[model samples]
Target: MTVSLPTISPEQQHALQAVLDEFGKTLPGCSLTVASDSNVLFDGRSGKFDALEEETDSPRAASKEDVLWFASTTKLITSVAYLQLVDQGTLTLDSDLSEYYPPLREATRRVFRGTDDQGQPIWEDSHTAVTLRMMLNQTSGFGMEFLEGVQGWKSYSGKGTGFVNSCKVDNLIHTPIVEQPGVQFQYGNSAEWLGLILPHIVNQSTEDYMQQHIFQPLGMRKTTFYPFGPEFKSRLMPLRFYDNEKREWQVLDQQMPGLTLPRSREEIEYPVAGGGIYSTSTDYTKLLQELLKLFRTSPNAYPKGALLSRESVQSLFQGSLPESAKGLLAHVMNMRPPQPGDAAATGEWDWSTGMVVWTPADGRRLGKDTAAKEGGWGRRASSVGWFGAAGTMYFIDPESNLTFVCTTQMLPGDHPSVSTMRNALEKQVYVSLQA
Candidate 1:
């Protein structure tokens, strides 16, 4: 189902341009693009591609080819890669994680048994075993603090020392499980562990398997697990984040004095699969497009060939959270409060694979229903994607056959630039569809 590109109305074009301009003024150095099912509706960039301190005030133009780190957005890729193995019968989703890593087999399954000496958990040992499905859905009883807290797990710090000393994959196996596997949703690096498991099953390194099976086949030329040499540096846009003290945004350089740089090859080459990818908007969009095609059309949706069966895709999207997870991990993932008409009030959503599965009533939380009413077309549901630690986001909307990508560089995560850029782009998409 190839759709023809729609012509943009003058009003819609002006509205989009205005929003892009505002993003430039507010974010400092950033690039953005909005596309319909058929064609790019808007593309714009402002700020220097390199370190701002080295470049002049004359902002360098961002182009379609400029690559930006997709960050945690790489989780979707890791998820798909794992699913491919499942499809090939290399591993089963229900397989016990302890089967591969034997130490986990004996690790205590800790459950909340009330408060302890320091008001911590008084855990009781359990008989249930953690499985691949539970880990993929973020119900593996892993603690979120390892990734969220400032000092908990500094393995992916890019400093080269923390990963070797304190953040090794083996360390996670002995870490306490806060809840029973498949009991709740606590988003973190479980998927990265799953990535580590892939190489063991397929008899190849994660990078090699991804390149041979996914990236090369899908034509994701700019996507890589580790940073490319200086040749690729010319294509990368400098990361930017807002600095409240200066009342302006600052551009980050190679040293990343106050920003997040791409993870070093040493950090990524290890089993830290969850957040190791470096990608461009173009490369990431292709992966999203492949997922969109699978969900909207058929499992054999790609021009290259079928990546996974339709049934497999359905299984990936179904709920993996258990009833006991209600108050614990769910609150973290569902940050938005229940709106007046939210289906979550009726117990409709559940954690599935690498994203939250939204029922129709929960669509408002993601700005989908509002976009539809405003005449913007995209998936109100039946879509899922995530961003990197450094303010990167992507989504594939099956309803409208639209794949959206937004990339930026910001340190410490949760920088205002991410939300500001996403909201502006979403509004423009809505306005464009209405026109």
Candidate 2:
């Protein structure tokens, strides 16, 4: 299991360093890492650990080991955990989630309808069942309030209450189904519900169960559901915010200015299985490496391994969303922007179990001009992975045996600074490979 780290060329290092420097100037404070198969090709840090002046007046440079929130990236990890149970024959992928929890049956049969801000019918009902498959594929029609209804649901009081309630298999019976499950792609709170199911089926706390099944087996020492100990403070990256008016990035300070210091570990500890894991780039990379290995080894091919059966992995990569669902998710991701005299531009993409799969030529949608190489073809087309709300992203390309993890702490998800830094780093990495 000893992996020999790859040697990074000095030229590659310098190129990556230049990208980081440019990002630091644009982003309030940032850190990044680029890794090939076994070795970290490039690692760079700039700015403070905490963006707030009161937290620390001086800029705290980010470190390779800084533990940052993975946000939605947690979904991938949670999905893996569930698959482990499937490996043990303790769970079934296609089993109506309601079979285990009756309230979920409602989830399977519900239809969601809504009125537009202008009192016009925005979305109509498309009858479908929200199955476990749909939830995993994100085609369950569960809308993500974080991105869509951020303003209204931002103040929703019940943070983890839904998970707590849904943990009871019986709760599934009473749970209201909002939308037809299998028809449309909606990145809602489905993963959180799935995470809650883990504890119920395993009869253990989610953290303890995942610790034994995933973290321990994979040797992801720095990855955890909650802040484990003092190590968190040392590894935690400072949260930064973009001051659009000032046209500058700044550390988040509650007293001096800006909003509160976001949520603290003490305030929320359920370790939202959907989006609440904090991890270092090194630790999270281990998870990605294991997944790559899983694909390489071609294990049981279904939900029957610590990772996934090669076949299951392949199925997960296959686009699961129908045309309707694909269109819905594209809108939710803001992948399409309104153009003059035309409807919002939509691309041909589909949601897999835990990743986005692109068919041939889909790279153009993401603004890529060239097609990917054979082994590297998936880089711009078919791939699976997720990024955090705090500017962290990782992608695994089974076709190329490549995995990349980039970490930074930028607040207000999708800040322009974070996007700029990520795009710059990704472009350099691709350029280096071509060279």
Candidate 3:
């Protein structure tokens, strides 16, 4: 199952570049790479690595080599790492989390009913058992400590919200459950919990395990949860916030909120597993390509051995929600403002292992009708994809046998500019593919 490179005509390349320039011009910087398995079809970039400011001498133009914060995109890698554990019989998807970590057994599952007349928080005990599957699918009732529901829980319990970003499991474990397990889909602390508890199961730091299992194997040298040293800083894109009044992007004076700058490599302790990795578009494309390979090829196809079995990869891509949770998941996906020139919503989405399982307008499943005319706006139905909080996004489309990675260093990831660029770029990629 050797993958051959797909050729992009010169006309198609030019058209893709034009889309990048037009849609990506406003942002501080952005890069997009579209590929199938091993070879890149198109790579285009626009804007500068840093927004031009009075203090800036010469801003570096955006390049494929730029290191950008992957933010929540790190969750996919964490998910992959844990799935590898499952492959090795270290744990199963149904493994009760309490068995590995006893605190979960003792921790009371608290659901916030609402506020009482005196502004006190009403609560209920959820007796549902937490499972690895529930954690990966984000149905574990974990709420982000900084968000509204969890914030109220913090006030009511007198527990500080510092644990959300501190990356410490002890504090994170104490964060109250904001909903009942297996009741609904809430994208909160589930990924972080997956990452924190990983070390306990593997008897190694998360960084080491991921390096040995995922990053090193995939040759993603630039990707890491702990991105330290001057070399990384020199290439890292500074997080930027757009000022509507000034009509310009402003560089954040400090690291993104909740992230503390590491003084040195040794100072790295609790890495924010959910949103802490820094990576280049090139490095991340390797991961996407590897996933595509796993989805399309068999085990013996790799002489050196694949990262995970095909069955494991299938589990990662398959939708995990039951009928009960689909309504709530759709509501969350619809809350984001639609990107300009975006595809019409099918009003359908569900959580896979660590990605969103989006049913394309065509409703075609992979391997069902290979001859179907690939009718879809962007991604094919059932494609597994997710975005970083800092505007990075990637999707592995098994139907088209393609993978896409777009990177930008902007805050409030759902900013219309970033979202529009991502959607437009994806549409253009499909256009080029058709050509």
Candidate 4:
């Protein structure tokens, strides 16, 4: 399923190791690995898989194949499924969703005009319609209602209840686009809608469709939306995080919504497109390798039997946000009344289907030219950066045909250390490759 690269010189391998060796020093309880098309250049960890257990270090070092939540990287998989359906002509990006599904017509936009007499944020109606494309790119303009207690309805799927007051419904794809669609990118709960809609298109559950079409064909033995049975539990690593302030690793007691690690079948929530796929670095990389095939194949003709065609591959990766996305993100950062006074007044980041892409101007010191599409296409542009979450990060460098996946349960995901780890790894990786 994954392409294997030809052997490199021992000098190159040693250079690679030397770069990772320095990086291993920086992570006390984490795993770092790099892989090329043909071989794993490095697979080593300085910390235990169960970080909270002091006795579990060194001898219990993490492996590259250990099952961990890929977090939002799951979105890339979901996007692939959606794109596959698109390729099959099951759906169109710009079609009015409500026209196809009346339940979507039932949803409405809720704007926070200001606070009411009780001091809660006042809301108003927004008539903007939602679309499949907006859901995929996060530009449908939905906010994280769980954090703000937006008073949304709940779903009782027996697994658990999540606030479904999303622009999309809790267990349905009918929740209204509460914010103006196509205006700007805001984190929304459309992955559930994606999961919901894809099944509608193919008449198979999202999990089953993905399992049959993507996972089974790619030899992704360990990836799943939920527990298939007892064996699935055996390879799953426990959930834990490091407390920088306490200088210690602890079993994570305070978990976030949609977190699937170390939980029971009844305790897990429905697999949202944005999150909720338990996977290993190796298995997900296999999926990535499938995409890489699109780029590496001569591209004159579909690679005989490639899973997806070159045109769909280009469409999947080529859409980008408008010029207004940056300004809208900056406005949201500025308008947050409780934001720290010293916080930067501007923000930089955009969506590529389900992944977060960065441009050269976005401040990534890419060692080579990225040649990223600027716009004039759909809002689904691509970037050679990453799509990650509170516990994990995956980065792809198109110029070098390189990808790195870092898994950790670090909380408040935007922590300085996470960025530090990504930066250090990228810097070393480039240095090693050039050497």
Number of clashing pairs per prediction, in order: 3, 23, 0, 14
Candidate 1 lDDT, 205-251, residue by residue in tens:
88888999889987988777666667576775656655667755564
For each candidate, the alpha-carbon lDDT, in order, equals 0.59, 0.60, 0.74, 0.57
Tens digits of per-residue lDDT for model 2 on 1-435? 223334457887788777877766545336555555455566677655555542454655666666777777888788777666666777676755656655555444544354457643334344654566777877665556433332122233223322221222322222333456676566676786776666667888888888887888878887876664776766666566666777555656541221122245454434456677777777777877776665655333423434565655566556767777767756654542112121223444567767665544424323343454442312555656666776787776555456777766776657655666666676676666555
Model number with the top TM-score: 3
Please give, for residues 1-435, the per-residue lDDT of candidate 4 as tens digits.
233353335676566556545544434335555665445565544444555555544445555546776666777888788777677777677766555445555554554444456655556666566777787777775655453422232221121144431112343443334456677666666666667556556877778899998999999988986754778655566665556787766666654434434355554444566766877766777776567557555656556656776766665555467666656554543442111242223334455665655443434343322442332111111334344555466655444455566655445455566555555555555555555
Ranking by lDDT: 3, 2, 1, 4
Clashing pairs in 1: 71-388, 72-388, 192-274
* Regions of candidate 2 where Cα sits further than 4 Å from its true position: 1-8, 26-29, 53-58, 106-109, 112-129, 146-175, 246-266, 298-306, 334-347, 361-366, 370-378
On lDDT, the candidate that comes out on top is 3
- Model 3: CA > 4 A from native: 1-6, 54-57, 108-115, 118-121, 166-171, 253-269, 298-304, 337-347, 360-376
TM-score per candidate, in order?
0.79, 0.78, 0.88, 0.77
Superposed on all Cα atoms, model 1 deviates from the true structure by an RMSD in Å of 5.1
- Residue 405, candidate 2: Cα error in Å is 1.6
